[model samples]
Target: MPIFRPYDTPRDGAPVLAAGGVSRRRLPLNFSEEDLPLFEDALEAAIPQTRLLELEDVGVSPEGMLFKDWRILPESFSSPSIMEQFLDRRRSVLKFLAANYLLRRRRKFGRDCLWIVDDWSAGYFHWLADALSRLYVARDAAKDLVLLLPHRYRQLEFVQSSLKAFAVGSVEYAGAGEVYFCRKLFMPSHVAPSGNYNEEVVRGLREMLVGFYGREGAGSGAGERVYLSRGRAPKRKVSNEGELLDTLREFDFRVVHFEDHPFEEQVRIAAGARVLVSNHGAGLTNILFMNPGGRVLELRRRDERERNWFFNLASATGLEYFYQLCDPENPDEGPHTANLIVDPQLFRENIRLMLAG
Candidate 1:
């Protein structure tokens, strides 16, 4: 008869041990009893009722967040010393095996999972590969691993490339999945536009707003977001400010030329506006925090160097969105290289649709 293990279907059963026929040698390392309980608590929350075989101290930082290495230890290796020594060993092989074992266990237990790792980005993916290769296993079980990227696409490509290099079989990217690998899957409670502000951060913001804007304006707060802008007049090559001014005026918005302010103040300003507008860039990411029905008027480059990520965000939150494409022709270059001018009619229509919606 086949061994009936909980790991066969990731969705069912407990996380199992994956030793690959080799017995594990535990390492000796000390962890404060208080810290151990806290870690155990987190593990329980992440994987309820799942058995954990503490193997080693995975990594540590000044912030006091301990990344422990764990595997589903078989009954024979249940002795704490197996985990103790695993912590002390610095050899790459031991570390690699420890991670693989734990990951294999997680895969066997949880069918679909969301990993909210603190900013591992693509670097975390590389570690997954290393752990698998050391054990001579190079297959990903049929599951989706979505990474929550702290930075934009350009910044994380290196890690993306590394994952591609290590992938043995076919694995496809899921644009939107039930789970995602990210520092955060949704806006923090403090940033959430709701009456019940349970999070300490959100409560703090509420208190600050009460002090700053009083109850009326503060009561209208949705989510806090930082806005960035070039403070000075746009140089000729930097942006077409004249065209932007004309187009913005057509939409009944008075262009406010200002320097970068503190993050809190920026959010405060955005909260007061019916529509927030900006060039295609990072500053626009703040729109993610806006309340549903709020509008984002983006000025996209005519060359299409930038693409809107609002598709996912809009789908997630019912926010009204519009963009005015700006084509900057290089007068010094040939006619073929010249950019198309902004279509004023398109700009007006987008604004009208947003209001109508």
Candidate 2:
């Protein structure tokens, strides 16, 4: 009943402290069942990198935007050519290096303006995978690229309606100097929920949500079973939610609540679901507007260990994920780990075996 292992020691002269996660645990020197596929291949998968690493000596000071292809925090890597990835999040990265050093000192946005300093800017799947990485890059690599964003993020109404499905722009602040990111690219950051999911960030968040709601038309007709009802968040409630919404309304589940609709109708009801069913929150990051052989399930809370970012965005958007941990009438009430308490006939037999398979 003891094993634990991790430090493969050689974090190339190791130094950078920490950012999080590393719950070392192990037990099975000679356990049975062929080591359960080496404990499910040492479960921790989230690898998704869609290449964007552009950096031509990025600098800009006054506290941030240094970038040598920023994305450092994997528990502060000790380096192995990962060259100590970095980020200075006291946030909005010093208001995007003081609005790119006052728009390159009043030369008014030289090199086609691309100053998008983000740190989950009010998350909705972390600003749809960090502000559209300049509208999915490769527009002749970076010609006349304009993705400013900083006008105090226009009071974040889903960041001003997701910046009208960009080709977007902003930045109305001034106060600092020494800017030179002549089109620096890194795109692909967020790491909170089992590593990080990438299929180019679920195909640039499903091509900016079908270029702002259009994949098979928006709204009305959206209902192939949804049930994402998280209700006024008192800590991810579902404590037998009226017997799990009467057993998910006997199967026609369309219980909705991506914050009471309107983020383009919550991507047209998660692209007219084909079975979503939620209990984890952030409205299951709209399952990246589902549709790619869909079916999510996900409901965990018993023993809650948080963040697997929508089960690794349901395996990078191929969505057929399923989970169900619930069990808490009061397992020590008050630590608030998504305070759930559902067991209504085992959460309706795991939602009737996930709607009968």
Candidate 3:
């Protein structure tokens, strides 16, 4: 790695070129581990000499987790910084990611292919969309643009939105200029297995699993559920960690609190759990990798919403699903007990049904 200067999109200090004018702009290729196996396979089959950079390694997220708490990017591309400062100590994780991948596009492998994997849901969508837009803009001289997204149907919908945007229009930010989108080379598929994953990736995942289990052992239930809600952010926004914690406490069964874990970790955690529950959120896409006979419960906001994603995932993995309703009376308004929102009595009954099968 030559440690080139970071790509200054905001033009904080140095001179930057215009998009349609061309002065040398940065292009990012983002993907995720959930899409790894399929992405790698497709890339190798299509362009095997391509180099890869884990967005986490270089520092980026699909939903812009790195940009949280700031308004540097527009709302669609906006994100909450994943990094948290504990007791005013160290910079958060997102800061580290931004610093590392900011402007340094390293040359790895032999090809010019730069593979970026989005570990956080919705975090990488804007980046992927913007990069595609750039490629499309530079189409006269642009090289091939390849994108790998999770193959599952749920994830496909998000990718589809970006691709549609690329084919039709570009999204513009105040300082960042217009981002073009292209449907042709922006391939969305399943995750391909890694051939050269670092020791840290493996070790960290294991530690995460251990930590998850440790929490499970200490909690009321011996199980974990990855709650998937719609969009990248939670619809019913609660204030502070205490309110969310209070929401989780309302459920009667022993449930491990699993929020904002990476897609890979979600799979690892779901596989180890006896039951998995989600609210038709994007994270439910990970259920495709859950253990056979693993249980799933979905809480839908409305009755008519389509969940072919859930159906396909549950069918493929053989995980049982128990769909329940969010108490209309509670209406997810204000701060109410989790039990009232979910109706603990009904939730327990559904869990019983899942266990029965």
Candidate 4:
């Protein structure tokens, strides 16, 4: 059976885990734990259990919350407070929802389903945290389950390969239909808008990932040092990539860019590392494959100060994660897409400490 930890559905039981609470108040309410934001919505759809009702119209529902229920999920630590800032411009959620929004398209599904919507289909980071774990939630009923996605996901090499490993065949995309329905629809809670990565999300996803990582084999490339490079970003180039690479090579670090290779190849390479080091980029998500007790040193952009995504991933996978803030290309300027510069001495010292551990 597919695994989703606290939100996992069972083979012979109610689809609705618990009846949710309701609210008429808006944001910033002093909410107790029992009074969840998505509870009422979940209750509305879950009341008629064993029912598959289809409406004549199907687009963004009037609710305006595609996956809000996930925040209230038992296994999720995300709470109603998050709803306050989720639609904010700074939150990536706004862009993600806008990108996946169906303007003049519709589709249908044949079984119970779920979807985790995002634009970066090929991004390993998005896959590990949102896409892949959401699949585990829907996989329990594979015979009668359909996963919805944008057409772009079909084009991604990692997306296709990951689906095959789990024997997943039921999938769909958005476009061109007046009526669309499903037996059950689950949209995983990314809760990305909030910069925090709580324990539940970490442990739950990691549990599902362990099986997939099993193929890497024991003691594969033991004590290997891998540096994930970000020389390919369209705008955020690593200005000191050459110097960093030269320094890392001196320590026997093998350089690899996840974007350069197929998804499986990337995982295969990441699986063997004892020390994985790189600038803060999507490739570091591969740290999920490394054996526990492995180490990660992330070179973060001082100006941008990104969310604690990989650090949480490392925590979940039992890898030791370390990070150092590096100056941006133009320190005087305001925030924009930018590269990073790491002090060579500082990085080498950190590497030395990592190896000693």
Whole-model lDDT values for every prediction:
0.33, 0.52, 0.34, 0.54
- List residue ranges in candidate 1 displaced over 4 A: 1-56, 60-238, 250-259, 302-306, 328-341
RMSD, each candidate, Å? 20.9, 17.9, 18.4, 11.6
Model 1 scores a C-alpha lDDT of: 0.33
Residue lDDT tens for model 3, 1-357: 111112222323321111111111111022224433322322211111111211211222323222222212211121223211211233443363454345334222221222223333334322232333232333322234333332232343334443432323232111121111212222111121121111222223333334433332334444454444332344432112232333345443333333555433444555556666655444555454455566777654432223233543353345565566554334555321222245555555665566565
Give each model's clash number: 15, 4, 35, 1
How high is each candidate's TM-score?
0.37, 0.30, 0.36, 0.66
- Scored against the true structure, residue 88 in model 3 reaches a CA lDDT of 25
lDDT of 2 by residue, 83-114 (tens): 22222233543454346545555322344444
In candidate 2, position 229 carries an lDDT of 73
Model 1 error, position 30 (Å): 61
Best by lDDT: 4
What are the per-residue Cα lDDT tens digits for candidate 1 across 156-265? 43334323433233332322211112221111001111111112222232233324432224555432222224335333222434544555555566444333444344
| Candidate 2 to truth, TM | 0.30
Q: Which ten residues in a row have the lowest lDDT in candidate 2?
A: 1-10
> Any idea what lDDT model 3 has?
0.34
Q: Residue 355 CA error for candidate 2 (Å)?
A: 19
- Model 4, range 40-150, lDDT digits (tens) per residue? 322221111121212221232212223222221221223344433443333455343343354324344445555554443346566666556545444554445466665
Query: Distance from true position, residue 251, model 4, in Å?
Result: 1.3
